[model samples]
Target: MAYAIIETGGKQLKVEPGRFYDVELLHEEEDAAISIDQVLLVSDGSTVTVGRPLVEGAVVEATVMQHRRDKKIIVYKMQPKKKTRKKQGHRQELTRLMINSISVGGKALATA
Candidate 1:
């Protein structure tokens, strides 16, 4: 079994093929193809490899499942006994990705 930790959008994620995750939105459309190449660490059951920043010749391939917005969040402010109130809402832009494969030196890793 193999797995890798990769960075994107200033965050690191443990990823493997066949799993899905929400990441920062890309300019591509739904069902589009994408690749990520910032692998930081990789482990293959018996051995573990860590990169200084990123492993050379390592990459992760993924597919864009869709573009969507996260659930809206409400922000509120109130002043006691002052009849002052404020409300706000926010939604985050997100891209849904289905991990296709993770490879080091162009070789796909076995499922973890």
Candidate 2:
């Protein structure tokens, strides 16, 4: 098994091939290919490579599966003595990604 740790949208994720993740929304459309360059670490069965910031020539390839919003969250504000109250709901935009491959040292490995 192999895995890569990638940074995206101010978050770190451990990615494996054929797995899907929900991340911050990007400008691209659905099914578009996405390349992420912020690779922090990669590991194979016998060896591991950790980058100072990010490994050179390391990239993660993924596909944008869909665009959607997360479940709604409610916000309420009230003043006990002023008869003031407010309510709101919010849903954050998100993008669904399917990890295709992760490459290190110009070589690709199977991730599971």
**Per-residue lDDT of candidate 1, residues 2-78 (tens digit):** 78899987889998788899987778888888888898998876888899989998888889998899999999999
Task: State every prediction's TM-score relative to the real structure.
Answer: 0.88, 0.90
Best by lDDT: 2
Backbone clash count, each prediction separately: 0, 0
By summed lDDT, the worst window of 10 consecutive residues in model 1 runs over: 103-112
Cα distance off (Å), candidate 1, residue 105:
1.0
Candidate 1 residue-wise lDDT at 63: 91
RMSD of 1: 1.8
Per-prediction RMSD in angstroms?
1.8, 1.5
* Candidate 2 C-alpha lDDT tens digits along 58-112: 8888999999999999999999999999999999999999999888867886643
